[model samples]
Target: MAKCFPEPYDAVSESKAELLLYKALAEQLGPDYVILHSVAWISRPGGSGPREGETDILIAHPVRGLLALEVKGGRVSLDYRTRTWVSIDANGVAHDIKNPFDQARRGKFALLEKLKESPAWKKLGIGRFNIGYAVFVPNVGDGDRLRGPDAPAEMIGDRRDLSDLGAWVGQVLDYWSGQEGAGQQIGTRGVDALVALFARSVSTRPLLSARIADEEDVRFSLTIRQAAILDILRRQRRVVIAGGAGTGKTLIAREKAVRLASEGMRTLLLCYNRGLADHLREQCTTIGGLDVATFHQVCHRWIERVKAKNGRDLLSEARANLPRGDEFDHHMPMALANAVDTLGPIYDAIVVDEAQDFGDEFWLPVEMLLTRPDEAMLYVFLDENQDIYRRSAEIPVQGEPMVLDRNCRNTDAIHAAAYSHYRGAVVEPPQISGVEVNRLLASGIEKQAALIGTLVTKLVVEEGVAPHEIAILLCDPADRPARERALQTLPLPATVKLGRVEDFSRGGLTVDTVARFKGLERAVVILWAFDRCDVGKDRETLYVGMSRAKSLLYVVGSREACDHILAAQT
Candidate 1:
């Protein structure tokens, strides 16, 4: 009658001992407790790559708080000299395994750290209950050789503890869970909250999947200027649309690709950002004859095709033979354009997003890829105010540039904060009503990271915003690791996943650099500005980060920078 979370069986192992123990506990403890299996946590290494580890079993009781158990089956041997635990199989071969006690302890620390971030843990007042750990060896009974000074009596369990069901529960509650069986307990309200918290923490559904499912409820309408650009795109073969953030540039590009594909035109969608390109691909995959690629990806694919045709990778040869600087993007296209006659256009139409990020040299090869450079359909979307990379390429176009001035994404209050960076830029007029942007001032980078974690938790747990709707964007590339480490320490809810923008879901939060999220929007954005405090030097970059939020925005930075930003906004 006990509630089980994510099922009790393990696909990785064939052991039935853990389930047997579960059944015994259910019969003893009744339906008041919830059992969670295979709960996992990501371990962030200091110098090495992150590793993920899972706990075998977690039992949550209203009276006992929480218990983590490491369950093992079959014959187990302890090499007291090497201090190693091994499982001896039927063939008499020893399989090296982690110590069950150590495994259970690690799970305890991970869960404690995770719980530290959740407000629910504090709200339930279950903090008073002891978080316990134990090791269950159901196959091994209390024998002559097994019980010794090395074997801790309370932590280890054998057949004797398993035989008398009612007595075993009493022993577990007393020795393992640290409860004397009465008085030291949780109320019904506290029990309910703890059960819900434990269930969510161990849920198997990926945060991104839930967010994608929730995106159906989000509503957005194209502005008059946006509709006009689409109308013009229907008639013109080649056109350029320029607009600032929230002006619907990405949306326009996506719609054009889908429409062209619907007409059976082979369309190629291009963007400078790989993450945005990935998102575009997902959005356009349903349409036949529509392909999405980043500028570098397209170049790599073309090089691969050339290698297949002529048995030589021209791009690699060009990189080695050609006299070029560190600007690979600028030099790559120029180097390849010299051999453009060898390659021909592959698509009926090409739609480029984030055009401002491309240099002048990068476009020649891109233009050469068009089957009919002049007659074939081409649509380029750009916003000069968002040219954070400082590329000054005049986007190749056939006619007067179409401009979208209405901001359909951000509210009037959010626009006020973003527009403070550029005094006279012809940006979009804010159309939505939004929460007032806040300037979170911290003394240092470490403090800033801590502050951001707290703010994100508050927004998700207390403010009722979905984890996926929130984004923490770093302004400088150098600050990625520090920001990631800081985010790891926060006790974030289980529903929010930290990931890159291209593959993110609406059900979880995303932590990425500002550049990767150029074309994306979030309901709440916390812009980390600790790297470069000078707003004058990086105005466009600051503006790009500020304009990403649709509803709420918190600009987190050093004290001096935050004060300066607040003053300017006023």
Candidate 2:
């Protein structure tokens, strides 16, 4: 097989044409060939808006030299009058695209100029070798029919040519051999020079941020497999999605909200956590019809709206009659229901995440706030495994709930550690083989804090990991204050920033409990599982905390706790 750049191709490449050509080139070509996908460069830094030239696929063969291939996938046709290429998308939408042959020619020249800057190119004098350009249209067949004034039949690879790529390459080489300065021959030494020159631009450590991106790449592939469900959601009036963590519930909810709002519906996206709500709000800021907030935010907004209109705060009157704990439990949601009743239905649709935390009282006003109670779209995403808050969660929706089975967020190691305590339907672990789950033993609270602090310092100062990428989660929120005090005791550098998730981007390190940090992820997570083992409720808390780490995970606890984890892994 041919050696490919990045070893595994990026899952989210925009051009399906290029991905198809990349796989074919990698599998069918001999070991001597090197294929690079999406070879991009900024040609002129001082240009008006920075000129970028990207070759879809650059194939290097020792004897054939470099071939710049531009691929066009969908139904391709040409406008005779304007000289523009037309692409018919899956939706039967026709859009004008640039001529593929012209693109290949430009990319070929730009790459040649860039490659000449390498010291090896001048020393070996391989610049005189055949440097060719070709257009590969995987969707269109019969290369002879594709011939035009600028596009020669022999220089184009069509659908039929894909079956025998080697034969097609030979034909292309033969055609290019007749060109100027053709076939001086790029020998083994010349190919080595090209590969060596390309390697220098990409030599660096795979940081935590990069690994998290790799996880997202795998998640994206899995998410694509789930795209069929979007049609089902569109047809249904109400849906309650049931899944375990990493099954892409939050991702689906975000997409659903965006789609509904884009269609001019007044949509409300609700979640349990404030941090998650803030993140959603940030994502949908430019989206006009989408109102994303927490359950509490919905109550506060409605209650305040009523007060602003009538100059009477219904919530304050309700709070006077309710007990201390009953304020949020009964007073707030009831006031919201009353406020909704007065204002009538304002939202056309409502989507909820972490629905497992929403109580029966919470659902009363949610359904009432929808413009058409019977027909309005309602989506509820829930993972019962993460019911740490333990509410009634009697979501007022009707359906034979859709189940998401794959856990696409955490790696195999993090997945194994978390799912051990979970008691639910099977959720398949991620396929990526990430770093091993580390169980570091520390007897006391002080020792645990010291271990985490030292590790954080090493990650930030020594290893060059950004401070904002690390999060320290406490198993028990009650122990959060003591842990924070302990972590601050160490004489660490001022660069190591530690705060809550709201200030997380400000400080590289965030300190929060597992409950608050739910529905969020960081690159590195130091979980303080020390002596908080209750075997009952703590299992759910442990599951949520451990899974929050997307890349690197470390559990600091007592020797017994460490031993328990070790035994489970074995």
Candidate 3:
């Protein structure tokens, strides 16, 4: 009597166990009855291939046509709370074992099919032997301790008790052997007959249906990128969003925030930097939607509002309750640590923008705030390619990424030029039409500025394009002297070195850093200043800078830099 009977057997274990059981049964029941295990019995055509089905063991006697057995080894107790059997361990941890009667009933149908294939079965007449169930419990702690409702099977406390088993087996054989002369009984057809018999035998009723009602659809509209983000949010209980500059990752985040809020689900929009948080907050406000704040700000509000209402000093409490492996460094921000400690779960969804820049440590507190399997979802947006601070920044996301490939904003020419110059890493080209890209060589800063200024005048004045539709992008904002000269020489009002929303006035010509202008699009012209010599390493910066334009790209660079762009185009 093994204590670990029916202990989580897989296909191989079940096969091996079946073989051992067959040998044991032959010795106990004598040579009269036939014992079979793991027999492939197929009836349904063009359905799933024959695999493991219910009946694991079958016994047939001259009088009895077939008998099915389900076995297990454990102390079973009735769960008064769950109204089921509670199979507990030595440490009192309970496992809800599925009922053995259910297993026996399923096995009965499978056994009947196997019986029909046997010549001996037809000789005895299939209806002569009465089918029944046997449940073998090998190591019952107390033999008479019955739990829950009785099952369809004749419950045996211990299979090791050969005297009791041998007597019961003999009686069943004799009764069926006497009935062999009885004419074949006409019975109700198919699985329904066996199911009805098994139901009458078991005290606990069988489940009649397993279907559940469908859920109502939630109404929402989103761009492809935004829809992809929402799909990930719905499928993966945990996720990260990474995007390069100008990919509209933040815009996607804002839309997600609005949708979640509309559903009356609390949503949080988090950013690593305060400036980006402020920017998102402004955008969310303009859209008349959810509250967007930096993670630190959220924590500060919780400490001041939530902890105060509870009359607890959150900082002191956190210091006293610090868990192991959570030691803090001196340079870590107190506000961040306090927020991580005192922050209440206010949001159903937590969307983090600039996720790539938010290092590994930034996620530790955020992870604590998430509710497992339900209640909350996490979405992080980032761009590995636009990660200029990699040497100093610790990226939080680990593994190959789920990338958004289709360029929804830029034109094909713009996307093509960007990807070509940037080692062809851009996943898909843009969908827009009527775009042209040009590469020009200049020896110095003044020459580069003159070329950019000429392109701006031609696009705005000659082509009848608006000045606001044109953009002048510099790889490094520190190269402002040339940017200023170009803006001063241009024939229209020009916005120079604009990084934030505040810097964007009623537009004419917009000038900004390549990094800042990554996710934005412009019509007519993009004046990219590739003033540096290490053009190969800076190719991505140039590519992203040039692709911002809808109609035309005018790249101004040194001859050595221009050669790299020409080679990329080829």
Candidate 4:
């Protein structure tokens, strides 16, 4: 049967008859036609830029190219002279409406224009495709109401002729197959390829796969190393767990805090990054007796609490004396610890994520905040390879760290690319399969921008990737604005929101510097390394950026830059 992207049951409808007709057509056509329901225009009709044009049913046939059908459920009558349509309701009341045939024609051209602008058609070597438009009045007894100069013989049909939509579709396909043009006459291979293209376009299979990937990411599976860490936590009050990127360091820390909180322990979950801390807070809030905050947040709160208790405004004093720069974040906790000593230990258990981001000076205050400095439960998760802040103070670990080696995020292809730049001795293997890492060589910034635009367009339009699922990560923070400009150069589908990570929180493609996207992951990543001077010798930064992708990774840069990265492969 015809494969419907969304089955008729799930689709929203103005009337039940419309849904019934869609289901009937799907049952009639057997696996040859790919039918899409509620296809909207890439751009608005008669607008300078793209706008929404709604189409009821879209059919993609191997030989016929594309067809848009405007289905009218009730008895629809056409006034030839007035060029208007009157749809009769169940109450025998006629309501004047805009001509659906005209609407379908506009939708047809709108979709055709959209396809023409996309790079997918050119890549597939179908520069042009024959587009057909029809108005199907399935409930009308006589086809005469819908027929006139406004409705062509082939473009207008009723239930009598359109009921067996498969046969009608076959006739249209055969007619288009015999036409003379660059778009006509598909070879046997071409037919299959075209049909597959349409299937991918309308299918929700990718979303299902994405959901599975999301499940794999959010739900933790205990690896041998993770199990060992849990075992260590059970016995040891002071523990340090260290591993490379994608080694599930963050997952372990979150789970440890969750378990402690679930046991009714007054647990404190801390991280260096505010974004990561926010994520932890959300995850840990479900359990009781947990307080989640970043290192700076903890310090600030400690200062505030001390001031409130002693009636002394220490925050104002520290703010006036604190020096500003990149060192601000690294030094704030230490400054707070020096100024405040009266605050006693408030938490029974403490868990730190991204512990390497803090210095040794910061941990003394963390220790003081515990109920028992020597016996209180303390778990610190560390990955030195991801120590982008370059803290020099060595964290005091009493014994050997429990190392996690298996990666749960990146695919084999992604691991291969990231491993080429990895500095640590420990290597992580891929957990999932079928992901590919693609590399492109560009001569300059402009060339790289063009390449990014083309590749992303093809991926969204042809391969059917959700815009928000794709991220454009830049090595240098300065390149982010320029990269966003390049994204605007692309004529992507209107559904894509081209906003930065700071402003946009909803779906659409995200363009951000790799540093800002450190704690985030996407289905697909496009890493732009146009100006490598920013991270010329920093392998950790490069490695972190490369490993952010969960499935597909696209690395674009100059040949020299590309070669330099490839040379690091061991």
Q: For model 2, how does the per-residue alpha-carbon lDDT over 1-570 read when each residue is reduced to its tens digit?
A: 888874545423787877887888788888888877766643322212223467788888888778899888888888657897888877889988899899999998877765554345667776477878899988776556667988888898988888888778767866787775575788888777766544322111112232232232322433533453553575466888888877778877887787666544678999989988887787678887899999988899889999999887878777776756377768999899889988887787899999998888889889999877776788999988898887876788875778888887788898888888788888888887899888777788898888887888788789877777788888767667787899889866687767887775644578888888888877788888547567565778888888888778898998787666445556
Give me the displacement of residue 158 in model 1, in angstroms: 99
lDDT-sorted candidate list, best first? 2, 1, 4, 3
TM, every model = 0.60, 0.62, 0.50, 0.58
Q: Candidate 4 residues 423-469, lDDT tens each?
A: 66666686687556777888867788888878877887898777777
Q: Give the better candidate number (1 or 3) by TM-score.
A: 1
- Clashing residue pairs for model 2: 467-508, 468-508
Better of 1 and 2 by lDDT: 2
Supply candidate 2's per-residue lDDT for 353. 94
Using lDDT, give the best candidate's number: 2
TM-score for predicted model 4 compared with the true structure: 0.58
- Specify the poorest-scoring 10-residue window by lDDT in model 1: 201-210
Error of 2 at 385 (Å): 0.5
Which is the better candidate, 3 or 4, if ranked by lDDT?
Answer: 4
Give the C-alpha miss distance for residue 162 in model 2, angstroms: 25
Question: How would the candidate models be sorted by TM-score, starting from the highest?
Answer: 2, 1, 4, 3
Candidates in order have lDDT scores of 0.70, 0.76, 0.52, 0.68
